[model samples]
Target: MGVAGSGKTTVAALLAGRLGAEFAEGDEFHPPENVAKMSDGMPLEDSDRWPWLGHIRDWLAEQAAAGRSAVVPCSALKRSYRDLLREAGPVRFAHLTGSRELLTERIQGRAGHFMKPAMLDSQLATLEPLGDDEDGFTVDVFPRPPEIVDEIIAHLDR
Candidate 1:
């Protein structure tokens, strides 16, 4: 998980397809109010995110209970947020990271998305890189989506 322009959705979807796991877009779990706030160029407070994170966590738990592996793309920016999601089960994160300029360019390139380039700074400021204790690997976003997915899968294999 990373910021908005980190290619989480694209890579996660491809990863899910390759693994034959259930896939969910994390943004869909956000309440309308959260979406509205982001759309209006306002960064969401932690209070606004708890419920949304809970919904995503619940969905992950549901998938695990059903005996299915699931892939979800989320901007899990904080260690606390990642900790909350870990309660769902054995969650492994793949943090897609890149330079600020690259992230801004990617965000600007998107269209019809609620997240805008102007909001990237807020997200970057909020992001906490995966800690050594975390069950995850960080991948550079410079690679193609397939390459990124391949790297993540390779790490999982290790």
Candidate 2:
């Protein structure tokens, strides 16, 4: 999990492939209204995200129960959100982090996504960097997508 434009999707996809897990894009599960709100440059309130988070948790649990590991790309910007996800089971978050400048460039270069570049500020404002208590690995998104995936895998291996 990470902020927008941090290449979460790219890294998650590659990691899921390498791990033989089903890959799920968190954006795909967003409610239409949430997508519309983000598209209009509005940040989602906690109330707006609670149900969505629950949905993700349920999906993750289902996958785990099926004995299928899954890689999910989610922003999960808050500690509360991560706690909710953790309730699902032993899930590891691979956080992709980068400087605001780099993320801005990525957002600017992207096209046709529901999340507008303008919302980046709100996202950053809301984000609480992962704490020591969280179960995950943090990788800076600078080298390359493949390198990011490799880093995540290396971390998980430990």
Candidate 3:
């Protein structure tokens, strides 16, 4: 989990492949209205996100019950959201963090995604960095993607 443009999707995909786990892109589960709102440069309200979050939680629960490993890329920016996922199952998060400037540049360069760089501010504003009590590892997004994947796997292996 991380802010927009922090490479959560990229890292998650690589990690999933390495772990032989299913990759679930949370954005693909967004409701059309939510997609439309985001495409219009609007941030999603808590009310708009609750149902979507519930869906993700359910999916995680299902995967966990099936003894299936999975990598999910989601912007669980709030503690409450993280708590919801935690209640759903046992999971570890690998947070990709980077400076605003770097993230802005990355977001701008990204194409074919409904989320726009203009929405980055809203995402950053809402993001609450992972706390000490959270079950996860935090990695800065300066290194290459393979390095990031290696770091995450190493951390998890520990």
Candidate 4:
């Protein structure tokens, strides 16, 4: 998981392919109201996120119940958010990180996404990173997407 333009979607998809796991995009789980909020370039508060995170957690649970491992790309920007998701099952996060300039450029280059370039700062402000106790590893976003995925896979193998 990572901020907007951190290549979370691209890297997650690659990871899914590598692991032969089911794939889910966190954005797809957002309620219309959440989409509307982000589409309006408004930063979502924690209140705007709980229900959405719950939906994501449910989806993860569904996949696990069906005996599947899945890769989901989400802006799990806070430690509490990740903790809530862990209640779903054994979850592993792969956080992608990069400089602000790179993130901003990537966001601006994209089109038709609900997340606005303007909201990147808010996301950065909200992000707590994958803490030491969190079951995850961080990969630099500067590498090629496949390379980043490979790094994540290497960690998983360990």
Q: Give the best candidate by lDDT.
A: 1
Ten contiguous residues minimizing lDDT sum, candidate 4: 129-138
Task: Give TM per candidate.
Answer: 0.98, 0.97, 0.96, 0.98
TM-score of 2: 0.97
Clash counts for all predictions: 0, 0, 0, 0
Which 10 consecutive residues of model 3 have the lowest summed lDDT? Answer: 85-94
The residue ranges of model 1 lying beyond 4 angstroms of the native Cα positions read none
Name the lDDT of candidate 2: 0.89
- Clash pairs detected, candidate 1: none
lDDT of 1: 0.94
TM-score order of candidates, best first? 1, 4, 2, 3
lDDT of 1 by residue, 1-158 (tens): 99988999999999999999999999999999999999999999999999999999999999999999999999999999999999999999999999888888898999999997888888888989999999999999998999998999999999
What alpha-carbon RMSD in Å does predicted model 1 have with respect to the real structure? Answer: 0.6
lDDT by residue for model 2 (2-67), tens: 889999888889999999998888988889999988888888999889888888898999999999
- Expressed as tens digits, the lDDT of each residue in 1-158 for candidate 3 is 99889998998999899999988999987999999998888889999888888888888988888999888999999888898888778878888999999998998988878888888888889888788988998999999999999999999999
Clashing pairs for predicted structure model 4, backbone only: none
Candidate 4 residue 32 C-alpha distance from true site, Å: 0.6
lDDT of 4 by residue, 41-104 (tens): 9999999999999999999999999999998999999999999899989999888999999999
